[model samples]
Target: MQLFAYLESFPILHIFELLELTLAIMIKRLLFEEAEITAREFKIVAITGPRQSGKTTLCKHVFKNKHYVSFEDLDILEEADSSPRSFINKYKDGAVFDEIQRVPGLFNYLQTHVDKVGKNNQYVISGSNNFLLQQNISQSLAGRAAYIELLPLSLLELQEHWGNTKNPVFFMMNGFYPSIIAKQSSAERWLPNYLKTYIERDVRMIRNIENLNLFSKFVKLAAARSGQILNVNNLANETGVDNKTISAWISVLESSYIVYRLQPYYNSFNKRVIKSPKLYFYDVGLLCNILGLNSERAIKQSNMYGAIFENLVISEIKKNRFNKSQYGEMYFLRDSTGNEVDLVLEKDGNLIPVEIKSSAKYRSSDLKNLKWFQRLYRIKGGMLINQSTENQELEDGIMNIGWAEVANV
Candidate 1:
């Protein structure tokens, strides 16, 4: 059965009926659409993302007929690590290899097999550690495999699954990890363990960190500074580490797909644009956990509420574009004169400035940065994504878009 259908077969109580239905609908992810399109052309396909983001589930659901093996099983991993050729021979027809990064040596053998067969859609590989998986891919599987990144679920996908009743604060607090949503688990209970596993497994595998506690502190500090321009020196001082170590740790976070940096937009017209990139987590629920905000009410009242909301909208835009198999050319705009826009999406020579506001109340002044960007760049239009329920066309090719309808924008 499909993942969602399998979940639906459980006997749900009357009180839990609505949530169960929502989970059932969410089983149909946007990445499946991208996977189907990619499978037709590539001899091997790889899906990379953070753990529990549903990489394995996606490959299994989309390639139901393919034999499946997971490297997490130590016996299988040992065999593949010891003798990759024999392992590949065992799955000649094709197979989905979960956590393929565990056995990087297998890539070379798989490459040889696929080249010999000259077959399309011969293998599906999934890994949570992008640094290792991508490095191995470049060294061995380049030009032989297609790649897709599957992040936590998108707001649009959640809306399609649950309808319009979900509060924005709820999404901000809970985030979009599929397991948390599908099983109706509390983020507080789940995210701490998730962080522990990430630090203990992926972090150690990526780099040698003698002090795991210090690394955990750095992660929390990074979360505290989410949505702000990255300052490695400051982070280093706070964590009592050298600047280079701080940089390397941040790279670990990024390569593991735990955090992303939004590069600042630069144009000849504005020489004073900020050059530093802003930091953001892939899932707000994880951010909330790092911040110790357990409930929706807590999230709404927290000091970082606006920043977290902005993070969610920015992440949604990225996820939406990625799901459609489009490269995301997203940036943030800020100048020394204090003009700033939350997100600047550049595509095909057209610039779309998006302003994010946490309040439901919309005012003309809320779009000041967007208007300033349009004027400076001579861009025809911009978007204001806020909590307003109605969409409105404001002055000067600017539109006030409700947060729920951001996918349409």
Candidate 2:
């Protein structure tokens, strides 16, 4: 609010001066267009993401005309839980429901109401818990609701306001959480509390875990394993838990949007590829916090620097894809002998292998895997995302683009 007030208080002459220099523009989420389009096509639209990712803010901004209701209020939850039909009827015209997963049974009443009315855009619902929200959607609003996954700010979204002066490593350490970035707060101070709340609230709501300490340790251990192939047995040994428990915790992490498990590309061409999936954090800043790296110097000098950079690139690409409403499959390719492509993006029925390197200088040897994968699969093009400032074309139709340029693709 202060940010807006400060902008409004700026002299009108200065505002026009900034506009003439093409420096003034509205700071908005790229997913706004996708959500607005979905609202027009479906009777119910569901926005889901991690806690404090600005889902509620985006919903309120897009559906401002609709009456806003949040289940976080105990009174509203009580009313909805007791009389689901009445709650539905009260907002028969249209409404935006925040944290709808809090009352799963309400979805049934919503389904009946929308069916009777046979109208589009009757309700917009959002929740942070994907497991519970998706379960309710599958049971009640299967064909009626369109889904959108919103992550934190991507580089493209941030460049709208901050420009391109910041580097990839800078974001890798501080992350793209909107509230922290907007307030210019220290990630070290904010992310720990955010992680604590997620563990205390969302995890308990999702599954019964008697040992919060053990679960917290499991999360930190998983963070240390970012950008590496997931090993359930190793994690079990390290966390003093069984493989089953480790697997379950990983599922909980993914469902809560704390981590992502990138499955390996198994479509082999006369070679045995690694079948295990790679683990990556949804936000690298959270990963850094979990590892106790509070400073840029600590992050750059840590042994996990390469892993952090890799996670940053992959997660940024993932966020950009979601922002653009691209729901395509993305995977990593690794063979038995350790030849691998960091990422494989599925678009238009073709697999484009991508090589991710933390090096600032381009080298021909880095493109070896990209060329090999292209020739083996008979693919025409591939991408190499690195820290370089320049873009160039290499052998075998492969293009080397800077990390910030991922938003464009």
Best by TM-score: 1
Q: Can you give the lDDT of residue 147 in candidate 2?
A: 91
lDDT of each: 0.86, 0.87
lDDT score, candidate 1, position 175: 79
Off by over 4 Å in 2: 1-25, 268-271
lDDT of 1 at 3: 65
Q: Candidate 1 — which residues are off by over 4 angstroms?
A: 1-26
lDDT, model 1, position 81: 97
* Residue range 300-362, candidate 1, lDDT tens digits: 889999999998888888888888766549999999889999999877767889999999989
Candidate 2 per-residue C-alpha lDDT over 137-209 given as tens digits, one digit per residue, 9 for 90 to 100 = 9999999999999898888888777776497667867888876676545787889999999999899999999
